[model samples]
Target: MIFSSQHLLFSSLLLTGTIMSISSTSWFMAWMGLELNLMSFVPLITSKTNQYPSEAALKYFLVQALGSALIILSAPLMMDMDIFSPMLLMALLLKLGAAPFHSWFPSIMEGLNWPQCILLMTIQKIAPIFLISHLVTQTSIPEFVTFSSILSALVGSLGGLNQTSLRKILAFSSINHLSWMLIAMLLSDYSWLIYFFFYSIISASIVIFFNLQQYFFFSQLFSNPLTSFTKSFMSSFALLSLGGLPPFSGFIPKWIIIEAMAYNHMFLPLLVLIFSALITLYYYLRIAVLSLLLMTTKTKLLSPFPAQFFASYLTPSFLFFNMFGLLVPSFFLFF
Candidate 1:
């Protein structure tokens, strides 16, 4: 995890590109930012230690290139022809890995390191989702949007049921959350923003936990000695919160969205999302229960004192901030 100068430079460029893409006023500038982000991430994904990185880099490049091409190809028609709207929207959906377009997501996540996975799931989504949200406001395609959202929710829930890989499970989880975000996009005003903000916090926390444990598989969690009772409890709580179970901070954003959907009278879509969310919670609980039940006392995992200190602080600090909403529910009422 020691960063070379090249890594630092590329990381900076990655952030710059993400910021530029989201802030750009013109399509061409946004496209440039996307390209910059992609190129920078490619170099970062290449590892001297593994071939999976190379294969993942290639697959990521090809899919992203196709999306960028579609966006560029359809940009000219967006102003005049409403027919091209779906094309542009599809391009963004592909970038976001929303199902039935989510085939590449798990494979790609499986290939990358934890840091890369974090960027892939979190920051990398900013440009495409932001653009897609803007387009949803401008164009009138309620049915198509709803269908895509439902399909993503269904795929995300059903797909993760058989996966043993932690990364793949998280990938599907991200897809399911994307469904919530998209629903918030369509019906609620700023609820999507609130949802996405909290989503990132919860995701970053879980990813950090995995990174600290060096866990990539479900079975690995049971074998890791660092997973004490306290650690397991906090970890389970984090996953439940991310699953949007009631009484957790994750539910706050969902609550905002539900209230907004009720106000908008989107009962059917709301029901579908709620059902899919329950399915998603099943897998989260499966993993969480295993964490609590499986305990090994041998200390095989080694960490520097600094890392231990950080992890100790990170677990409680993250849980406290996330559950802060539970203790003071009124703070988020404005959203």
Candidate 2:
């Protein structure tokens, strides 16, 4: 995406809205913030050059509007009626695209650009998740959320298995990660925050790499001869990291969550999560192996040029973090 003053304005509003929602003390204020966020993001999704973005914006708007409506309608009744708590939880789950309600997420992502997809997967999630944490703390809804988390893990992992679109794959991956974060939330207060922080970093790196290469589908990795070995390798490594391979930065959060879950005697959900993660890793490894080992040969006339100064520097820096970032958790553990 091209950066414009308009984009800058909406982006700022988006951040402001998220901050407002997360920091709000009352449900009404939080609803206002969510509305601000929804409106700001719709403008960002609609693009002048793309017809699909308009469709995506409409779908996104409808889903979010429904969730917001549910939230507002249930907020007043929440204190008086215990039943409304589940209604509110459902609204937030719909907003978060947690499973059984996650069908719209990949379709919406399919129509978006990389940056918009990144926002959908990461920043757009913060408020709803924060509110869900609040709800979890106040209510006895572990069975409901646990079921959703397990279903989300299964759906997210299975949904991406046959996808060719990179956007959709990442969408499913986000849902899968959402399961883990939900589990983390149940395990401890700050563990989910730690999971989200690392997840955002790894996801951003992978999405940026995809954006730089203008790759939309898996086939592009194998067919695009312009992709150099170094670029391919770096991207593959990043994908592996995002898949939560051991020793990578991405695994640290998972390890922490696993340890926490074990301590809490949450074996069933932990087993399901581990199984789903392995399935998720399969696809990532498939992509990495195809891109790195079976790469297409570069033609002489269509040979790739040397990497740009900025990309050359930036790619390695991202890879460095992904490779050695595990040291952060390790350092704390030992010291």
| C-alpha lDDT of candidate 2 relative to the true structure | 0.89
Quantify all predictions' global Cα lDDT against the true fold: 0.86, 0.89
Q: How many times do residue backbones clash in model 1?
A: 0
Model 1 scores worst on lDDT over the 10 consecutive residues at 296-305
Per residue, candidate 1 scores C-alpha lDDT tens digits across 176-247 of 999998888887548888999999999999999889888899998787665566667778888999999889
Across 10-60, the per-residue lDDT of candidate 2 in tens digits comes to 999999999999999999999999999999999999988899989999999
TM-score of each: 0.91, 0.93
Error at 288, model 2, angstroms:
0.4
State, as a TM-score between 0 and 1, how close model 2 is to the true structure.
Answer: 0.93
Candidate that would win on TM-score: 2
**Candidate 2 clash pair list:** none
As a whole number from 0 to 100, the lDDT of residue 38 in candidate 1 is 92
Please give the distance, in angstroms, between residue 223's alpha carbon in candidate 2 and its true position after superposition.
0.6
